[model samples]
Structure formats: structure tokens, C-alpha cells
Target: MEKKAVYPGSFDPFTNGHMDIVRKASAIFDRVYIVMAVNSEKRRAFDCRRMQEAMERALADSGIRNCEVSIYDGLIAEYTKHHGIGYMVRGLRNNMDYNYEENIAEVNKLIDPSLEYVYFRADNVAVSSSMVKELRHYGQDVSSYVPPAIAALLADGNTER
Candidate 1:
């Protein structure tokens, strides 16, 4: 039997920190699914298709095997239940993130106690998708914070910069 985990995120623009969590999760699980959550509250510069393509390209460039990417448009716990994913992988950059994610984890636990939440501390605190997006919006160089493929996608987008 293979152990599968889901790493759900908006991933508007995949960042290096996100990749770090993916890589770490990949090592711990037989399969790691990088799920792009569709949230109306958060708008993305690239559509789902483009985001998936960029993520695939970045993962390939990084030589991260045993990982898959897909889009989910509902509650993460429900999606995980339907997909037979037992674990939810998350990345934490700071205490603020922990406070936010902890609340979500608690709610998800209440909804499904079988669901396990796994946290990964980001290797770098400053390399976040939000920061990358902000840098792009300000026309600052964000290549260092994201993979080349994602950086190019962000650079080409008019809304981001």
C-alpha cells in the first residue's frame, strides 16, 4: 500500500518555500498531491491551467518525482475524504501562519477526526507566495523567491506587476 498526502494551497504563484514543503513531503510519503484550491476570495494572475503548467514545469526542473498537481473546488477535508488522502500537508512560515492554520486544522479535525495535519517549517521565512506576488506587483525582482518557471509567469503577467 502506498501512503498518499495532499498539500492543498491556492498556489496563485508557486514559491520556493512552497517547493521546499513539497520536496520534504515527497520524501515522507509515497505520493504527494499538490492541490490548487479554488477560492473566490483570492484572485490569481494566472488561470488554473497556467498555474498547473507552471507548477509541473517547476517540479520537473527541480527533479521532484512522485508528486502530482490538480485543482479542487470545495472544502479540503471533503476533497481529501473523496480522494482517500489521509494526511494534509501544510507549510508554516511564522507564528501568524500557525495561528491561522491551527484554526483551520481544528475545524477540519472536527469535521473529520481521521484527517491528520502535517506541518512543515519553511526553510526561508521571506520566501512566500504572497511576498513573491507583492514583489511582482511592485515591479521588483522576485526570481530568487520562486522557481524560474513561476518567476517568468509572474513577470509576464500585467496584473502582478
Candidate 2:
């Protein structure tokens, strides 16, 4: 079976930390789907289209051709089963995230036994989507945290790519 994984997140702004996970996952999986999950419980600063566009541009610029961006609604396990993907990639910024992801992983495992979660810890947890968003909100340049293409978008005072 082809080794494919789903990296699901809101991705309000695709950060370099996200790129790092994609780059790493590319080495192992034949394909990585950067899934933009629209969970009603979480709030987002940017819409899915803008996030998808930024991701597409970043992927092209970063030369990560093994991955593709797609939007999905409902449980990720269901999405994975529907798409025939067996692995899910998740990024953890800290122990707090791990605590949360661990429970989610258990739930997902129960939902689909074939589905597995691959967790990658960010090397620079200080530079996360929340941090970038907070910095940008204060009119600060977040070019170092996210991809250059995305940083340009934030620098432009909007999420246009």
C-alpha cells in the first residue's frame, strides 16, 4: 500500500513549523495531504481559501511537491477512511499539545483502527500560529516564522496570496 498521511489543522496561517513537518513527512510518506479541517469549535483568523492558497504557494516555493492541500468537513478519521489514507500527521508544540493529541489519537484509533497518528514536535515552539497571529495583530513582521510567501501576505496587512 502507498504510504500516505493526512496532516490536519486549521492552518489559519501556515507557519514554517508546519513546513518542517511537511518536509519531514515527505521523506517517509509517498504523499502528504495538508488537510484544512473546519472544526466549528475552534476560531480562525483567516478563511480556508486564503490558508489553502498560502499553503499551495508555500509548497511550490518550498519545493514540497509530495504534498497537496485540501479542505475537509467532519471527523478526520472519516475523511482518512473515505480517501483510503492510513496515516495522520500531527505537530505538537509542547507537552500541553501532546496531552490533547494523545486523547484525540485514542479517539481516532477507536474510530478507525487502520488509521495511525504520526506526531512531530516543533523545534521552535516559540514560533507558532498563535504567536505569529498575535505578532501580526500588533503590526509586527512575522517573516521569520512562516514561509516568505506567507510572511509577505502578513506584511501586506492581510491574508492575500
Candidate 3:
């Protein structure tokens, strides 16, 4: 059977940290679904289609061939289950996010004991999606924090909100 995993997130504009996790996960799983969470509280300027497009462009340049991008609404556990994904991939930047993710992981496990939670540590604690958004908001250069294609998308003024 092919190993499948889901990495769900807002991915407003694929950050370096997000790309890092996807790249690593793609190597381990036969197929990695780069799922964009449509119901996230953090509203994005771009819609689901745009987010997926930005992610695809970024992943393509990063050499992650075994991954596909899509959008999902509602609970991540349900989405994973429906897609036949036994594992959900998450990334951590620091200890601060551990508690929150751990709680969510527990709930997901309760929902389906067969569902596995895989966590990857960010390459650098300073690199994060929030930081990238802040930089873009302030008109600062965030090209280093995101893939070139994502940088181009952001530079094109798509995420003005």
C-alpha cells in the first residue's frame, strides 16, 4: 500500500518553514497532501484556489514531486479520514506551540485511534509563517523566508489585507 500523509495549514503563502516540512515529509511518504485549511481563523487575502496555486508553485521549485496541493474545510481529522490519510504532518517552531498541537493531536487520536500525528521541528525557530506575514505587511523583504515563487506572488500584491 502507498503511504499517504496530510500536511494541513493555511499556507497563505508557503513559507520556508512550511516548505521544509513538506519537503521532508514527501521524502518519507509515498504521497504528501499539502492541504490548505479553509476554515482557519486567520483569514487570508487569497482564496483556496489561489493558496493552492501559490503552494504548487513553491513546491514545484523546491523539487517536491511526490506531493499534491488541495484545500479542505471542517475538521482536519475528518478530512484526513476521508482522504485515506493515516498520518497528519505538523511542524513546530518552538515549545510554545507544543501544548496547543499536543492537545489537538490528542483530540484527533480520540476521534480515530488509527490516525497518527507526525511532528517536524523547523530548521530555524525564527522562520515562521506569522513572521513572513508581518514582514509583508510592513513592506519588508520576505523573500528569504519564503520560496521564490511565493515571494513573487506576495510581491505582486496578492496578499493585501
Candidate 4:
């Protein structure tokens, strides 16, 4: 019985903040699945394939072998159960993030009560997918927030100096 945990999100750009949470989780769980959640309900900036690639590149570049990236479309609890993972990792950046995650946790508990949720605060400055998207929209460099591979993609699109 291996200990596996999931870290699911859109990960529009795999930011360093996101990597920090994965790093913390990997220490605890034998395997950390960085699921790039593909929720059809939400109209996000990037697609699942791109997000998955960014996460993979980021993880490989960081030399993180205990973690892997996957794509999920349905409910997250279902995904966790299907993969036999009992833990889920989330980065609580602020009070709002806590509240939102708490609410989601309650719902997920109803679906799979055996599942556990692990929370970690941002190791560095707080970074969110939405903030990264906003920064890129303004053609700003997001090297500090996102990984090198993602930074290259963002830089290619940015027109502002």
C-alpha cells in the first residue's frame, strides 16, 4: 500500500509557488500526482495539454521525480479514488483560499470520507493562476512566479517592454 497524494489545479502556468507545494507534499507522500484539472465548466486561459506540458517541464527541470502530471476532467475525489490515492495537497495562500478549500473539502468528504487533505502555506510569496494570467495579459514578465519553461512561453507572447 503505497502512499499517494494528488495536487490538482488548472496550473495555467506552473509557478514556483505551485512547485513549492508539490515539493512539500512529495516529502510526505510516496507519489505526488500534479493533476492539471480540466474542468469543462470553467473558461480558463490555457488548455489542459499546455498546462500539463508546463507542469511536466517544470517538474523535470526542478529534478522532481516523485511527482508526475496528469489530466482530470470529472470530479477530483473520483480521480483520487480511481488512482487509489488517499491524500490531496492544496496550497493555502490566504484566508480566502482556506475558506474555498474548506468548502470543497466538505463536499469531497461526502464523496470519499477516507480521503485526507494536506495544506501548506506558500513557501515564498503567494502566487495564483489568476494572477499569472493577469500578468501575462498585460505582457509583463512572470519569471519570478512561473517556472523557466513557462517563463519562456510567456516571454514569447509578451509585447510590452
Clashing pairs in 3: none
Q: In model 3, how large is the Cα lDDT of residue 30?
A: 99
Error of 1 at 82 (Å): 0.7
Candidate 2 lDDT score relative to the true structure: 0.86
Q: For each candidate, what TM-score against the reference?
A: 0.92, 0.93, 0.92, 0.91
Superposed model 1: Cα runs more than 4 Å off: 158-161
Candidate 1 vs candidate 3: the lDDT winner is 1
The lDDT per prediction is 0.86, 0.86, 0.83, 0.83
lDDT of 4 by residue, 107-148 (tens): 998888899999999876557777888886788777888888
Model 4 has an lDDT value of 0.83
Considering summed lDDT, which 10 consecutive residues are worst modelled in model 1? Answer: 152-161
**TM-score, candidate number 2:** 0.93
Model 3, stretches more than 4 Å misplaced? Answer: none
Best lDDT among the predictions, by candidate number: 1
Error of 1 at 78 (Å): 0.7
How many clashing pairs in candidate 4? 0
**Cα RMSDs, all models:** 1.8, 1.8, 1.5, 2.9
Residue 41's lDDT within candidate 3 is 65
Residues 1-161 of candidate 3: C-alpha lDDT, one tens digit per residue: 99999998888767888888988899899999888887656777655676678788888777778999988788888888788999989899878778889999999888777899889988867887788878777888989998887877777754554
